[model samples]
Target chain A: MTAQPRIVEVRQKVLRRNDVLAGELRDRFREAGVYVVSLVSSPGSGKTAFLEKILTMMGRQARIAALVGDLATDNDAVRLARAGVPVRQIVTGTVCHLDAVMVQSALEGWKLAELDYLFIENVGNLVCPSSYDLGENLRVVLMSVTEGEDKPLKYPTIFNGADIAVVTKIDIAAAVEFDWNAARANIQAVRPEMEIFRVSARSGEGLTEWLASVESRRAAKNRPG
Target chain B: MHELSIALSILEGAAEEVERQGGGRVYAIHLKLGSLSGVAKDALIFSYKLASEGTPFEESRLVIDEVPVVVFCPECRAERRLSSIQQFCCAVCGTPTPDVVRGRELEIAGLEMDV
Candidate 1:
């Protein structure tokens, strides 16, 4: 005789392991006094350029490091090393995104307390990265002028998950006819009141303001509740 | 694209739950997938089938309950169901609010098993 199948109650998160690990990472970052920032975007959105600019500009005053995620190559890490800070490349192989476990393992020998700022450049895919949290104080989603104004609307999930939106390659905005107002509107439509930064990493436009905003945000993170 | 990974995680979670229940053959898995969870339901279903091969859940059915995005509208002082995931505003008062109260759930609600 076959027994009847019964319904079992199991209210559990599928990503609970990742969430727990991320929570631990968040606590560790807090104790170590390092401001962690993560960048996410579709491929060729100028994330590497923007991050390289930030690292190069802030390297003099801050103890900085970066963990860059890519499918196969260390090319980005090689390029970013020009800034002269400690940089590590996380080769994800077939994986599309970086989870907390990857980030934890990547920081094996590094001392988080010695660093003032740590940047994680996620794999250049908007969809998968939105599902995982890397314990970062800020998650910046970048969209280049060449990607069109409707990028946010098309990938609303990633934009909605991010804390800030950055418009990259503004120096060539006119060549691409990128509608700033339309892009901002689309982003606001999805995220509502999200802080945005317009930047040109090549020409150094808006770098000062962006840097100031980041510093202030980091300072605010250090404030005790 | 990462649905395969998500499918594997679901299998892992279900297996643990089954083990905790003294071992059972799961026939169905109930999942709550949110609009903002960044996972597509159809892709996940397909991936689940591929991931479940040779496992106890090989023949299991994944029943997904898609949860719509809901945000807290401060202007109306109420939780409102968003009409569209693209626009995060109160359906009633049209107040724009970033305070999302629900709709990011990717959880296993229940499992049907033969113990």
Candidate 2:
């Protein structure tokens, strides 16, 4: 004779642990007066280049640091360090995404209060990174001109997860005949009213507006509630 | 790729639940996965099997209920089911709204076990 299995209600979020950690991180950032931003996108979308540009430009006006994640190499950290801002590399080994635990551990020794802005560059992956929240004030998703306008349509989950969409490598938009309007339309189709920024890290096009917008956002985040 | 991690999380949640109930042999784990949760159902099921191997849940079954994305339609003044994630508009009114009311759920709803 075998006993029948009984159903037991256990309504719980699977990622509750991550969510709790992220909530703690958010409170920590708020107390430290640091505006945290995270970047996510597919590989070869110019995340490092754009981050490098932001760090170099923003370094002059405010205190900023970055934590870059990759599957194997610290190459991105080395590249970003040239911008003169504190950069840390999180080698995920075979992991494809950065979770809240990784961010919490990486910030173990850093003084969050000393920095005005903290950027987390997630591993170059659109799919996996969308699931984990890194406790960022803003999440930016990059899509290069070479990656096609349909990129957002193909990966709506990531686009929906992100707060803003950045079109990188606009300098070669003409060379690739990338339809800017179509890209914008596609992004809007997936995530309505999503703020979009067109920038070229190589040519420095559209950097001024983007930087100003980011600075204002940071200011707003630091404003007393 | 991240499905393996998600499977592990499910296992951890189930184990905690079993312990809370004074320990039991888990027969099945019920999960509610939303379309916009960014976790593929098939991949998670496959990963669950591998993650359960050699564990107490080795013979346990994973039951997933896939939930579709739903958005609040301002024009319709009601919640509407979205036909496709690619389009955020209401299925009936076609009003574009960013107010997502549902989906994005990765949760353990229940468990069947014998204590």
lDDT of each: 0.94, 0.94
Task: Give candidate 1 misplaced runs (Cα > 4 Å).
Answer: none
Worst 10 residues of 2 chain B by lDDT: B93-102
Which candidate leads the pack in DockQ?
1
As for candidate 2, its interface RMSD to one decimal place is 0.9
Clashing pairs in 2: none
Worst 10 residues of 1 chain A by lDDT: A216-225
Candidate 2 deviant stretches above 4 angstroms? none
lDDT of 1 by residue, B9-53 (tens): 999999999999999788899999999999999999999999999
Q: Please state the error at residue A55 of candidate 2 in Å.
A: 0.5
